[model samples]
Target: MIDIIQPPKAKQVLKTLSMHDDDRHDDYFWLNDKENQEVIDYLNSENDYYDAVTSKYKAFENTLFEEMKARIKEDDESVPYKFNGYWYIVKYKKGKDYPIYFRKKDTLENPDELLFDCNVMAEGHDYFKLAGLSVSPDNTMIAFGIDTVGRRNYTLQIKSLITDEIFFDAIESTTGSATWANDNKTIFYTVKDEKTLRSDKVFKHKLGSSTSADTLVFHEEDDTFGVAIYKSKSKKYLIIACYSTLTNEYYTLNADTPDGEFSVFQERVRGLEYSISHYDDQFYIVTNADGAVNFKLMKTPENTTKFNNWTEVIPHREEVLIEDVEIFKDFLVISERSNGLNHIRIKRWDGTEDYYLPFDNETYTAYTATNVEFDTKTLRYGYNSMTTPSSSIDFNMVTKQKTILKEQEVLDSNFNKDNYVSERVWAISTDGTKVPISMVYRKGIKKDGTNPVLLYAYGSYGHTIDPSFSSIRLSLLDRGFVYAIAHVRGGEYLGRMWYEGGKLLQKKNTFTDFIACSKFLIAQNYTSPDHLYALGGSAGGLLVGAVINEAPELYNGVIAAVPFVDVLTTMLDDSIPLTTGEYDEWGNPNDMTYYEYMKSYSPYDNVKKQDYPHILITTGLHDSQVQYWEPAKWVAKLRTYKTDNNNLLLKTNMKAGHGGASGRFEALREDAEEYAFLLNLENITT
Candidate 1:
């Protein structure tokens, strides 16, 4: 390893942020100015130091990268799903960095017709992402959104399938989707505010017309809410959904009448959340109405689309949380979670039969997959766990027979699910809450405190971190490492109550819960603080940052990827992405109570002059979600305050965004680098 004579110093400019009559000094606030040459130089210097520090482990990183890459099948394709007389497929060719989309008509024997080649679109761009690939109702034209810069401001364009012509008519700064009206010419899309980056406006555009000629269909005036447009599965109505963290409201437009105005299916009510799906004569509402904290199902007449006219289809259940619903002609598949594991309950539309699809593992993720056809008896779903490869299965709803359509093939022949063991364990928190942790390790690995363990979690926005299989994780498992996921409170792992208990005023519970899980593992001899490490991304990255401030002694090292560390400052500035819309999750800092509460645990605000664990902080210059400046500023602050001579590194992906690298193989290189860091720190060398 290269010896650093002296760590580079970041020039500090004293800047104090004021909130609730209190002042907090942010010495590194100037780092947020991305245009400054000094700021860019600092980031580049940090990146150079990171590379130099890890130079000795480059061979290990390469081996790790190659092994992980080898595990993945060179040429992989997704299970083709039938839509509108054509079977659509997304496949990756060997050595290609992008997916190629194709469609075949009527049967598998038909030749695949090329639709879009992302490889061609992604050329000459540092970052590229294609989203919302939608074919027109007539299947004559296609509308897709592409983001070349990583800010998520996509430029939408239309393609003529018959003429093989790409139109230059571009709609900029969209939410990366376009919902086509039944007429196949009128398209509705949502646009983000330039400053706030909130999707607040919906507009309608007719083909062959200029974007300036498009009409603004609707505008969500509420700063806390955002809007999106999509067509119902039934293809009868174009739905406009405006939502915030706590509530949702939907408006419907008759697809047949392109010129007609949309009417509200339900008016917006605070704390009232619902999503709609259409059947023959009624609209099904999956909602948390009438004190159904865990959510329930209801139905209303097509014409009388008010909450008052709704009738219960599946009433509230105290133990179950309805995560999603899939409607079919003969079945209503309810994707739910109970005991922190997913369960798909299939019920006949007539209410005659009801049963859950069987899942073998103690902790595995299973959810309803694409079932666009309203006439099918077969229900498609996906299943996987820490040890199981993902499998797509089609189950005969009537016969109760499951046929595996495709299972992910791990190219490495040495890989075997039978060689690994997974367990669902519980950890007791300081508040006596039972936190579930799913852990997996290679067979014959002893559960002793001497072994290394990587605890991962994302405990915010009610996003559950389900136990899913990863081919890349095999490298860790095979090297005497145990992988565990903490089902902490902020996630809806247990139910809505669990999420409620960990957010807003109770947000500290998330950090404490993670710490508690770590202590429990140590107390149980699963791992010790000396060998324990933590990993989280984005808000979860915030979780790692906050917990380390509170209990730095409990971890040997931790990785924070694209973290939102400067919470108080970020939340106070509504111009940042996700700030205005996230008031409900992390209460608006303008309010004194929220300001004080957030100030109490804000990671960057709480950085103290004390020893901390070895840390690896990463970010992207073009990250649209958590700005790269947050982590950059955080590392700068830590350098000034921390007393530790222990390792501290910062990696900035100049070409990537929130999600690091976009390519299939390029992403593995990042995973390899992370693993190399962990392994090198553990003194594992070959």
Candidate 2:
């Protein structure tokens, strides 16, 4: 057995926070000063302690990493996607960490044109990401965004595809995407606020012009709103979209008119959420207007885009949630979710034929993928389940023929889909709501209550955690572990109502639902409290933190990755990134009712002296969405308040941001460390 090393104790400088007649004392608030030398020292000390405790199993961690990495086909390439007049493909050479963007003109037999080799571009940077590779309509110029610090603030740059020379025009602090006007020389991009990193302004830039001369096209004056620029799929209009949590407004300009003023599509109405897509002469809208809780599809003439002028194309159904729509010259494809499974429905423009794609899996994810060409009858879609490898398919709407473009290849010779089983089970919450749990395990594993089960969940932001295949997860399944995902509230797993029940005043439902699922697993003999583990990241990290605070005895170990646990404090500070925009999801604490409610369940504020499960927490120093300090302060408080001798470790990625390490192999190492932590607790160190 590895000896537990003494953890670092952060010095507590008493800081008092007051709101709505409530007073809370924070001791580790001093750790929030990222620029302070003492703060850096404390974080480093914690990391050092984590290394010391886990050093005994370092070899095992590397072994787990190699085991996971061996399953990947290293020299992999994404399925070719055709856009404009070129067929574009992203490929990675053997042993390379980054992708090489390639293209072919006219036909697949043509010689490949090298667009960008990211490995060469990322030579000197510790962290690198390429985003928004937009090719001009004329196909000679390309605009892309690059981020080296992982804070998500990308620098926009343009390159001449023919000359292979990068232009002198470089714009900084952008959201990393540029929407080109039909003129090809003019582009519109969004810039973020310096401190908060909120995308608030849209600027128009012309080729060969200094950024100082760029015109501010629009500014989102509301702090709660963010703005982004994009061209419609039809490529007829450039759009500037302004959105808050509950409201959306869009401005459109004809693609040919680069200097023309943009007209608002529809006036913003509170609680009304909508998205727009362009067809031939009309605009297709998917919205939750007129009390359509599940949302419906509507169409309005492009010249007159207003709510009153919109006509219903697809009526809303209570059981079905219209997630997205793809426009084609001859057909319209709608992505929908019913119960907890995704369905793709195809409809011809003349309304002569309409049908849904068949899926046999009880729990799987299917969605539209890279359908950039609007004139084709073939629809590109992706499919995968808990046990099935992902496959990209092209389905013909005319003949109902399907072609598999490429399927994920698990390089392990011993891996087989038949060796594993996946199913969906419902767990009844305290409020009588039936929550779904998607689980997968080895076929021979018995429900003997001795199995180690990892319950994972991300119950926030209306983002559903669908059951998808992961080659790395074979390490656990092959070792007799049952992996499960609790479809809790705060996510749109069951529908919009499920998310509504888990946010704002009802946020506690997200935590309780996860706890209920854990208990249900225990009662079913799939796992016991001694063998059950929990895992979540970001908002999901908030879920596990709140869960352990409510019922720590139920879990043997917990892994919180980049957790947003400092709720009350973060919500009260609007200057923090994403806090103002998140008021609708998590109520603004400036209000008295929200202040009291948030204080009641805030993970850091509610830490008490009690025996807790072994915990491993991770954070990235440059994380912009959830600042590094939130997790740092959380770990400090957990160490101070918890009375258990169980392992409590904090591992911070000093150079990376919220997404963690940049290289594919480096990411596997982090995952291996996490799995090692859990396995070490079970004493499975082999």
Candidate 3:
């Protein structure tokens, strides 16, 4: 049995190491003078090739981008809500540093009325980029988070939607999640002390408050983490989710006061699962605690706490993957995956009468429910997929009437959903763990087993990277390439057990599972090794780096996006953001056991002088999630140690963070570059 330890505990020994110690292995990449120069030489060569290939399409791509921008009434526009006889919509424009834009829904098409070039909210420091936007119920205030780069700490800022006047000082913390109270006067967010990663305190920021010094109403000091807080629709209770990393213990707290320290009202149906929604005062959580890919929907009475209160509303089905759950009035809309196809169903509270809704003409790979609102006569909702853009319509419960309000990007003549086919398949892992793999390809492709395939995966930190649509992927699939997502361990695939089986020392199972999927594809005659490519970003990028190091010959090309390559270095640094907090997820690396384990797989340190695959290492200059310097240093060292002169391309986003480009066109352009790179590698002409 492998004893996997997370790296946050490595502080003591690493702190003792002198910065001047030349023999110290604190730096992820340590190369001699000759090796350093050799790596630089290799980088220069790859850069030449990358530049030459990108140059041909630069002008054409720019022209296509400008043309695409011209068709949009605004760079990007959210659905407008009619309030106080005025149509209000959140508009985002290209080239604007700030996320906010002012636009009236009625004068949407008029260029003069649209505020595109200017920032609705004045620009702040680089660290204060908008994290989220929540308009008040009355449309008077806009609540948003301004997070500092590198540091996970943030200040929740509330601006008057009417006057655009800012109110209150920023709320700072190491918490990644936050929410506004329905009253709009108070903002509820989780804050962790820099010293301990496991302990968390919930703070309520009242509008116009100057400091968080006096605003902390509740603090959980033990080894408990709190997140995913939201107010009940009736405003009578506050629902907070608290979980322990040592044991998969989760509980729901129902507090009368939004920020009050409350007792655990209901224990979460433990093991591991995602709580999707809480509607009609009943919880709708997805959990595979029972086993397999099938999940159970357990709903307890409001304010009740007990296993007896946990009633199985929807029993698990083996073949179907319940992707999402949406509550609209008296009905619950369940989005699911069956036989690689996406479907939706409406179920009543009694579960007796359920209607299978038609989800015809799905061009994208994945979709999500946008919103649900009661319109007196009917309930209105919206849904969108990767290639399909977004569509909105209203459904009437009384009359069984369905009316389409608007379809996103449908008017664009250049929009083409026919370029891609989204698919879901299962591959067994080393332990015979059934992994879900989602694939995308152009419509009408022969199973000639010659098409290039890009397999993607991310398995760590209890995060689930679900399958969804991507418009940009069409650029690759339009050629003869197949893009697939491998749902491996460290993710919530079959719920908590699946994640447990893959986390800690068992983390290697994630990489092997990905490798297994790749082999499975080749064995099934879907694609060959010569044409297979693998890609992953961030933690997913960690997956890519590990796989390439472990089985480089298995792939023709590899793309590692914003990867955490310097795992050992990060876990040792106290100043580094989220390092201390992530101790629960990754063990302390300073200990001999953890240090040895991390050294075994740390990509930057593990770069050996051996034959390697064509690799693309892309990262952002301003990425806060995985530091830009990580990939920068890793590529520098890998180029030196790798025996072959295979293309090891490094493309760093100069202005973006982990998510890459903020603008729609800029993002698509980056995607186009990525797809273009993959297509060139596969010899697939678009």
Question: Could you tally the backbone clashes for each prediction?
Answer: 0, 0, 16
What's the TM-score of every candidate structure? 0.99, 0.99, 0.76
Question: Where does model 2 exceed 4 Å of error?
Answer: 1-4
- Model 3 superposed RMSD (Cα): 7.6
lDDT of each: 0.91, 0.93, 0.62
Candidate 2 displacement at residue 260 in angstroms: 0.5
Q: What is the C-alpha RMSD of each candidate to the true structure, in Å?
A: 1.1, 0.9, 7.6
Candidate 2: residue 271 Cα off by (Å): 0.5
lDDT of 3 by residue, 1-686 (tens): 01132111111112223332223443323321214564444434445555664665566555445544454455566666543334555566666544454545345464323222325333443334455555555557766665545344455666676565678666555355555555666666666665443336666677766654546546654343444455544344566656555323333444434554555654444345445355666665665655635566777666664445677777887767676776655667777766445666777656556776566543333343344342233445655554555577766655678877777653356557765567667888788778778777777777777878889888887666656655445455655678788878887655545666676567688889999999999888789878889989888888888888898888888888889888877777755545654655666665666666766777876777887888878876556567766886677667567777566667765445777765445566666566666766765443
Q: Which digits, one per residue and each the tens of the lDDT, describe model 2 over residues 355-389?
A: 99999877799999999998998999999999999
Q: Which wins on lDDT, candidate 1 or candidate 3? A: 1
Could you give candidate 1's per-residue lDDT for residues 1-686 as a string of tens digits?
A: 22564556788899988877898888899998889999899999999888888889999999999999888887989898988888999999999989999999899789998999999989998788999898998888888999887788888888898897976578888988898998888989999888778999999988888889999999999999999999888889899999999999999988999799899999999999999999998999999999999999999999999999999999999999999998888888999998888999989888799998877777688888888787889888999988999999999999999999999888887888999999999989998999999999988876668889999999999999999999899999989899999999899999999999999999999999999999999998988999999999999999999999999999998999999899999999988888999999999999999999999999998998998988999999988899999999899889889888878899999888898898878989999989999988799854
